[model samples]
Each structure stands twice: as structure tokens, then as C-alpha cells.
Target: MTDKVTINIPVQYEAIAFKTKALGFDMPSDLQTGSLLKTLVASKPGGRILELGTGTGLATSWILSGMDNHASLVSVDNNELLINVAKEQLKDNRIEFICGDGYEWIAAYKGASFDLIFADAMPGKYDLFEETFALLKTGGIYFIDDMLPQPNWPEGHAQRVEAFITMLEKRTDLVLTPLNWSTGIIIVTKTSNKI
Candidate 1:
């Protein structure tokens, strides 16, 4: 027999995963990504966390699991149906769910900066790159996944991903590490207020 190691799954994960599948939602954060999100979140006690895509709250559950009681999370998604699944499954006083265009939300947001940002959607990651980055507190982590090629990617997406990596590489205000693991992750920490 072979030994196996399993990451701790959040309480709401199974239910959310079941519902996500029932609803035919194909894009949910994998376990590897979720584990990393949880670890990153635990680093910031009472931190303010932002999640740009609440896909069935799969990642949300993980983020919440790592958060202390005083920590708060704001999750946004444009799809009402998908986000509603998240809202229904994950009930925590620390979480605030917003159903609207992520790009619009980022543009209009005028609140305290976040300690960690998980940009799972296109708005904060591919669009409004500079604007969204400004919301991150210095030393705060900016995490993104799905960086490697995937089956769901559309035509020309690879080039776009390459371009995005190049752009991130040129930034001088932040330090970034591109991990080849877990759907390809890029963990960036803002080192200055230069934006």
C-alpha cells in the first residue's frame, strides 16, 4: 500500500463542491490552490482579504478557514447564479458577498487597502492591473492562479498569459515568485507604494 497525505478540507467544501457540480460550474479552485490561499490568509491576523471571484465559494471556504475571528473578507463576482451558490453555502459574518462586475467594483472601491488579494477573475488579474494593485497594502500578497495552460483556455490565451507574466516581471515596486506548482501560481507582494 502507498501512503497518502491529504490537506484539511474546509467544513463547507464538500457541500459547495457538490452544488458546484450540480450546477454544472466547471471552474472551481483546485485543492492545491485552496490550500495555498488558506496558508497565505493565516499569515495575516485580523487581515482584510479580497477575493475577485467567488466561484461557488470553493476558494472562499478555504480563505475563511484560515482567517481569525477578527479577519474580514469581501468576495465579488459578476455571475449572480454562481455567486448565489457561494452565498448560500458559506455563511460567515466575516464575509461580504458582492454580485457585480469585478472591474466596476475595483474602479469604484474607495476603502481601506487589503492585506491579501486573490484575483481569480479577469478584472483584477488581466484588466485594471494597475488600479487593482493600488488597493493592496504594502507587504500584502497578491495571489493569482490558472497561470499555466489549461483545457478551458480559449484561443490566443497562452500569448496573453505570457504577456501578463512579462508585465508582472517588469514591475519594480513588488517582488514576485512564479511557482510552477498548482495550476501555476504567481505570488506577488507589494514592496512599495509606487503602484
Candidate 2:
């Protein structure tokens, strides 16, 4: 009963998966997932949000579009190339960009939980559940993308992903939902009223 996620894509699979799907070529995250994120922020107006693995600032833009004026976002990424793209794509003061492994920074952050969290940096064997739950406030939202057919993922990772899901379901104060779209994102809601 372990969870697992795959991150590898075969050429034949890529053909159908990325063919004519998003602004030409292929978008890592689909519009449906992006729009869902935006909607989450809009509904949770004024919420503090965190974007993990901000690739090229695409998701960052969507989060901004979904959030209200009072809300802010902190985006993290280890890729300098993507960070540069994010810098050019975003001009808002509310959005702060950080370049590094999310797990390292998260280890030092324990002040308060964020309202919304988007996890996109699924480095091999870097399941950030500990850091994610630690920073998530009660009633906050946590979204983890890329849980299916992990493009180039190591073997048995998909099983690990599933195990996490099973474990998530066992938590009493959290709600979990596995989306059936683009890579099967996991949505979790913390409701313990805790710090």
C-alpha cells in the first residue's frame, strides 16, 4: 500500500499527451489545472500562497490572475533559466521569487502555515510531504501536481505517490482529492485549526 508516481514520457505517449494541447507545443500543466489553481485563490481571497517549482512563471501568472489585491505569493525554483523567465514574466511586488531547493528553505521556515501551496518541484526521491504539512495552516489548501506517468521519473515512484495518497486519506483533519486530469494532481485541505 505504498504510493507511487511516474515522471517519464514515451514518444508515442507524448504525441497524444502534448499534441495541439496548450498555446502550441506542450504545456507542462494543462489549462484545467491552471484554471483550478486560479479559482482556488479567488475563492480563498486574501490568502497567503506558495508556489513550489515555478517553471518559467506560467503557474505564477495564473496564481496572480486568481488572487485578490491583498494576497501575495512566494515562488521557489532551483532552475536559474526558469527563474529568469519568471523575472521577465512577473512584475508585481507581491510575488517574491526564491532560487534553491524548496526542502532546504522549508526546513528553516516554521513561523506559520500558508493558505495555499502548489508543489511542482518533484525532484527524484524528494517527496516534500513533511515540509508541506509543516507549513500548511489549518483549512489551507495544498496542491501537488504531476502524480501520474511522471515524465522521466524513476521506477516505483508512482507507487510512492499512491502510498502518500493512502496515508493522506488516513489523516483525520485533512481532505484529499485525486484529480483525474493531466498527470493527476493531488488536492489536500487541512482542517485541524492548528498552527
Q: Which stretches of candidate 1 lie over 4 Å from their true place?
A: 1-5
- C-alpha local distance difference test of each model: 0.93, 0.71
Q: Give the TM-score of candidate 2.
A: 0.79
Residue pairs that clash (backbone atoms under 3 angstroms), model 1: none
User: Model 2: per-residue lDDT, tens digit, 1-195?
Assistant: 422323222112233333324334233555556667877888778888988887666667678878899998988888776666667657788898988887787776665568998887763114757667767788888887777776666789778777867777788878888887766888888888442
- lDDT at position 100, candidate 1: 95
Following a full C-alpha superposition, what root-mean-square deviation does model 1 have from the true structure? 1.9
Instruction: Return the TM-score for each candidate structure.
Output: 0.96, 0.79
Worst 10 residues of 1 by lDDT: 1-10
Instruction: Name the candidate that leads on TM-score.
Output: 1
